[model samples]
Target chain A: MSESDRQGGEPEPEPERTSTGEYVLGGLGGLLVLLLLGFLIYQAAVVRDTGPELSVTVTGVETAGNGWSVHYRIANTGGQTAVQVQVTGVLSRDGTEVEESSATVDYVPPGSRRSGALLFSEDPGSGDLQVRPSGYSLP
Target chain B: MSATTDTEHLATGVGRAVGGALLFALPLFMTMEVWRLGHTVERYRLALLVLATVVLVIGLAHYFGAGPGGVSRAGYLADAGVALVVALLTASVVLVVLAVIDPVQDRQSALSVVVIEILPAAIGASYARSQLGAGSRRPQAPRYGHEVFLMAAGAVVFAANIAPTEEVVLLAAKLGERNAAVLVVLSLVLMHGFVYWVGFGGQEEATGFLRSFRNLTVVGYVAAFAVSAFLLWTFGRFDGVGLPVVVGQTVVLALPASVGAAAARLIL
Candidate 1:
């Protein structure tokens, strides 16, 4: 309807500003933020690729679903992220394996610990329960 | 210029840069690969990745304001440098907050991880104009150079989304040579069709298939391939891999990059 449209004109409704003043100020602020952030990062950390050199100790045992629940705590001694850490427990009486049970901890960071319970189908009152790390992947 | 306007504008650009840095690189920081990449990857490779990012940020400064230098090479480079610093700052802060870079336990590796994450984050910051800045750089008639830049920008944005993860490598490993080749063909067709459907500003009219093919399609594919190679190298997808593996990964990643490239011409 307007002359600009009829003539196929390029109409810029908002004036484009390419000012330098604001960028200078922003750049200074950004620099300060960077310095502060750098300082913080220099003092921060994350889980490293520490694997299954974990300490699995049986703290107690409780009776649960049709079996026994072996309570244990796993601590990562190695400096790596242990992903999908699975612990296997074998209940044996007189050197004969009775029931096998496994517990999984989604992730255990280096120098960190996770507590879980492994369920067994049979009672291990008369047997010695041996719990160890089955396997783990690096996170 | 009034003092008030100057301060306001300065805050605007800085805020956008920092916000853009944090927002755009969120996905990358969340990825486990990015967090530990610095520890496993070689030093020279990381340097190359940073260098490539610097080059991209230079061009990106045109749309995202780094200075008052309009269209000047130096200005773009300065803006890019600013983008890099902002991105680094943003990444450092977030890494610290998240405890991904544990300074007390492994300070060196944590710093390295932040540096690695900064690469993608800075690139994301360089794209603040498109992502956050509302009408900062008004679109004009697309030039050949501008079109190429847009394609590259799009490619970077798309490829960055997928490159840092192990999935790209896994998918590439699964794809056979024949399948990869077929996928490349499909990618080309999609790129060509995309441009036709969403015409880039100031695109020329070409009636014949050959003419259109030569103009937009070929150019887009070339840009896609170039972007793909750059992304693959940045993500360290090429180390200890043979030629087949490299090509397979590059092409697989290039599909989305090409589509992104085509979209860039039309969107910005």
Candidate 2:
């Protein structure tokens, strides 16, 4: 039989050989890539589960006679439950600090939200009312 | 030419493809996490849905035309481009339809917007890295390595961007527009640049000096965070100063972590 017929048609071309450097480098690179992926996945887990550290969202604020009444919706956005959540409301007029009032809540649970009020007497002229969530100032 | 050669070639190809896919998945997951954390669930859900759709379309393309030879550079780019265009068009149509139907601002819509805005960018960046090193010899090829490097870089960026501690402090300080902008830009550039340099430096250099330098960077970052916190605290004492400590801490951690990762990538 002819060589071509014996080989069953034309012989396939030889595949390109990969170099040693390429193989070694590629393998190392692949391993590093895997390690990086593992690290990232771990990082993502950390970011996701790291419970409510401290986060406060202001819902509304208003003014009442004789003093300024401020309403705040506070939540312990961190993972751990906070014992005391203190929120301080500083009334400012024309970029100047006029009066400040604060209120403290007993316990704030992670993922749970609550509202509180703080009143300041000294009139903060016409300006924006600013509320700050201070750390858990214990009793 | 020979059966053995064909088998070896096929094996290497499969290995690289699997490695690439896994590498790709890492950033995608992290990106999802960032979206989930930075925004509401509805937003995250919407983004994920869109992303899934994009992936499906790409999958379909591969199933039919590409046929598992592993996506070529052009094929990957084309798929990504088409997916992006479809996503944008779908989003615009949805927005218009919603607007016409009396404004759907439910969790879904909000989430959709956030997802549309974020995921595309993340996916696009990932695709770019993949295409850059499509057929290299290395098992981990520069492209895939770069992708991992980018993900690590991204983690740092995400951490820095949402740095609650710095944000809270800056806001409390009542930093003027210029100062605020400057602070953000500087932090991002310096921190990200540090990371990129370390990453690009390669493993050996990264391990030698960069590893030891990391402690110094961390210490410096902590000190910087403390100083920022102190400034906020003192300013608060005077009035008109409300510090956001959480934001500041986030920023501090992101920079160092990003830089450290880059350094590790470069040297070790």
Candidate 3:
């Protein structure tokens, strides 16, 4: 070993930069901000159709709380926003409305689809289920 | 620059930041679009918005008051970060309690939703000193450009609360072409009146009515429209919508935006 290694004054240790509290707080804050940003970047992108057309498509019939329920999806095909959207499902037999059930979707934005369940006293699958958009108000 | 992490500094400042978040950002929390934004906002875009908000919050802290005096850059950034965290936490808690964020809400989307909210939510945190302190308003005649910027900021805040939902589009749809035209004129007149006639905050400083209209009111309205239009585009209000619809929505949004601009001149 060199003679300097044996000497006590070989090197001086640097002063400790305090602010450990700030370091800890800043570290914690940075971690949270990054984590939040990471989650935002990782999430899936939601792409809805563009426009103001409201179209109702019946997807399935399910047994709900009562006799039966018609499950349907409402899509806004037009280019504007429709508010207070009301959908009607009419069970028809020989051109007569056997059972009518109506469901409401509070809002339906253009290119977005929302679903609702229309409960009917009669079996939804038993008759020709005709679902139609009843009414909607412009936002 | 809230550069110092002293115990007292943390306590009082944090409490005030929380209060600011609640007072200023509550409307955003209740807005349907903001809640729905959790589901609809693109992930990457939300990240960008959050990042931008971070920079903006830091700038606000630097300009307004990050620390008691002479805050460094680190302090400004750190203070903004803390304020953002507080705002985000507050929003999440309130939303969860309100059932706006249900168990079924996608965690990623919920995070994104809450993150995008930081845009306006962070305002309360960074502006707490000016908003809450008694007799502390130091209103000065801002430069013309700064005046326009304040209007834009106010407009953006108001627009953020309105544009995300389907209300603007719905309103556009409901209004007949003639009705929409009338609304446009009405908006312009109101914007002019708010500053010139109403004598709110900044309006009191204007010269004559015509000159004020030309120099301040007219300029302010145009800036509000421009800001509102930009917000409308960002909010997808123009997606698949025609020019007429766009104009209608713009008018609807501009009214609030102009009011915000006037308020900025008065308040900020």
Q: Which tens-of-lDDT digit does each residue in B163-258 have in candidate 2?
A: 323344445345565654466456545544564344444422234456434533333344344433332232222233224434433344444444
Candidate 1 lDDT over A7-40, as tens digits, reads: 4765443433445653463365345434544443
Residue B119, model 2: lDDT of 33
Ranking by DockQ: 3, 1, 2
Among the numbered candidates, top DockQ falls to: 3
How many steric clashes between backbone atoms does each model show? Answer: 12, 35, 12
| Candidate 1 residue-wise lDDT at A92 | 96
Cα deviation of A104 in candidate 1 (Å)?
15
By lDDT, the better pick of 1 and 2 is 1
Q: Compute the lDDT for candidate 2.
A: 0.42
- Give the better candidate number (1 or 3) by TM-score: 1
Q: Give interface RMSD, every candidate, in order.
A: 7.3, 13.8, 8.1
Q: Which should have the higher DockQ, number 1 or number 2?
A: 1
Candidate 1 displacement at residue B188 in angstroms: 0.9
Ranking of all predicted structures according to TM-score, beginning with the best and ending with the worst = 1, 3, 2
Off by over 4 Å in 1: A1-139, B63-78, B130-139, B198-208
